[model samples]
Target: MRYLAHSAHAQLGSLWLSCVGWVLTAMALGLIQWRVWLVSDRGVISSGVAWVGVWRACFNSHALVTPGFRVMHCRSMSLAETFTPPEIVAAQVLMLLSLVLGLCGNAGGVYALRNIYFRTQEDSPVRLAFFTTGVLCLSAAVMSLVPLLWNLISVVTNQTIEFPPEFNMPPAPDSQHVGCGIGVGMVGTVLMMVSGIIFCTYRFPVRSQRPGGSSSPAPSVSHSRGAAVNDNPAFESHEDL
Candidate 1:
């Protein structure tokens, strides 16, 4: 019992690391989803494919059910069974959907970036920021699945009934994998947040000038012609009439 308790204690720290990693990853994904929704043109009725829709899709999860907020939290708590028997079929479906969206969104964004660079010799600060953000969110999303993958493998192999009491090997670099994941997730989250700030601050230049404003000097006229029109007796009579 003493050894089991000690094993559980050591494993609990790793569990906490997994929870932290998923939480950070979730935050990034949520931010990416929000940004996409914020900038999408509702009237167009199409995803922002011509722009950075692919990048936006990297974190979009509106239709996905697996690796969702609820499932992640439950699993992080080591309550997989308590959450309706894993829902393997449903989970698989959601995972496939997520994978498709993630791939599409990323591809679209990369293509857009290349198109912009080749067509217009200009780089938009906002697009760069958004792309950076999307990449970070994607990284986080991938990391978020690490614990689930580990657990799934363990279950399939029948290595341990309870993760908390098993896999308590002695301290080593591999043992700190969970910690590294959490750290990387946190970094990704911070990058997304900073990118969000940059995105918000970077604005496109407005085209139309103000009503009374001029971008160039007024054109010059022939002074003699002006004088003739104003001073000629014939023109003066016409003006009077």
Candidate 2:
């Protein structure tokens, strides 16, 4: 039992490094917006497509076309513009938390794995490292999901905002569509969750006694001054009983 348990524990420690790698990958992907599209509600002639991402916003107009080509212009979104919308703000915060937590989780997992394989600390530190890794990875997954869902919801239920005639832009589109960014983010979320499960499962360190070691008492030794053979019994000294 001890051998198996110790072996499994060591294997798990090594396994967690992969979890950290996965979590880092997911978190990195989560930072990008793959597919968020907004359609203009304006008439077809005045209608346009707008693409929003975590870092910037882009738009293409169907109104102005030369022969067969269309023009597209992209602009970096300001913090105020990116954060003004309630849903956007919520998503921004959640995704940020996910990234931060993922970083923390990776750090903790690496620390723990090192401690386990290298026997850096006696016992308590490694346990604490595992616990921290689990908590952080779990937190990162949860945080990632919130923003992914929120931003997606915002895309589907979004209403067209009205603009004055002076601005000359069409009505906000009724059928807003999600972009590839959101899809990629969703995928990242799933990966993050998988990593979280691994971290959580191995959070508790498995302790085992050293091989060939036992706490049981030693066998007793008996001493006698008598001969073993009956023929030699006569020679045995029994005080002339």
Candidate 3:
């Protein structure tokens, strides 16, 4: 059976999109600006800004001992810490899981697309590969999306986290908003979903017409036997007898 070139092209496009989504997801997972806090008055805090992410939190503030100068201070987040919010901990776990699933999905997608483009395997194996890749990609998308939406809601509600004194940040800032990390994560999730749908929709094209601009039908066994009998002189003589 012959496959259509357009189908291969579509698979290639989805593969590229999925690869990009995987990279973006990793970026979002590592980014430390999931939520940004804007300080209107510098008198309260030296640098007038702070941000928190799944893995860490950062603040622009004066040092604990040297109060005269300010610097960007970042601290690693821990689930054991009381100041860390449950939402952040969940986000951290889910985002990491999403990254792992996305990696596997990208690898499987590449293998499937390569087989499809080269027509290396039977239809069944190729179709199965596509299905597996689609499932993985979609799963990854959902995993990443949960945390992103949850955090977005938290930001909308203006949720606050307790900060230690050494970091020199307020429990809540004067104003807060979503950060670039969420934006990037949202984009990546969208791409992953689109690619997965495309992968799932794959279908092998029907046999096409021959180069002579006509389709040749397969000859039946009964017709071939009848033609052979009619063409054989010995069979005709025996029939006459």
Candidate 4:
């Protein structure tokens, strides 16, 4: 049980890193937009895409477009492998969390767009487009939950259990699963970052008024009327008269 738990934990960690890495890659790509404005280098665009793809693959399993090249290797069991129940639970939780992140991201993206429409009539097209793209990417991230769910089902059913002397229950090969996960994570991360950049660049920072400044006071109706009376001496002369 302890060995199973330990192995499961390691798998979870690996899964998480793969997803995060892909997302980061996507973010880096979105950041590329900023680079266009900030950097004047020649090869930045091509390099940025390459970097994004590489990182995306690194971070998430699903992003791996080609998994036929995975090398076969022997492995050993760890201490946590002994605790299978908790391990299964942990896997389910992680999978659920990923799905939630995707849904939340999409919802937030829509809200941001609505806010932009209501608050600012003059919004940049670039930002708006990116916001839309971000929502889609987040949706992809949510789709990555499929394999995790499958893994959970397998664990619950005790399908991985082995018997007798060679009771070592090794982790099943997960190349396809991991590849899909990485891809989804990358797409989601890219969209999210793009949305962020769009919001930041398009939305002008609200400046606060200083406590005491030389700026003119807001004109009030009463003040205006008082000034009118002052302009017309007849309106105020009754008291003096």
lDDT of 2: 0.57
Candidate 3 residue-wise lDDT, 21-92, digit = tens: 989989998898999998876654567777788887776655432334356667778878888888898888
lDDT of residue 169 for candidate 1? 14
TM-scores of all candidate predictions against the true structure: 0.30, 0.65, 0.81, 0.27
Q: Better model by lDDT, 1 or 4? A: 4
lDDT of 2 by residue, 80-145 (tens): 662245555566677777777877777776776666655534655666666677778778778867
What clash count does candidate 3 reach? Answer: 0
What are the RMSD figures for all models against the true structure?
23.6, 6.2, 5.6, 19.7
Please give the TM-score that candidate 1 achieves against the real structure.
0.30
User: What would you estimate as the lDDT of candidate 1?
Assistant: 0.34
lDDT of each: 0.34, 0.57, 0.83, 0.36
Instruction: Locate the minimum summed-lDDT window of 10 residues in model 2.
Output: 1-10
Give candidate 1's error at residue 162 in angstroms.
1.2
Model 1 regions more than 4 Å off: 1-112, 120-178, 206-213, 220-241
**How should the candidates be ordered by TM-score, best one leading?**
3, 2, 1, 4
lDDT of 4 by residue, 1-241 (tens): 0112221232233234334534553443223111011112223121222111111111112222234433211122232455333333443344345545544554554454444444434434524643553544444444443433444354345443221223221222111112233344345444444443333333333444656753466666555776888888787897478
**Number of the top-ranking candidate, with lDDT as the measure:** 3
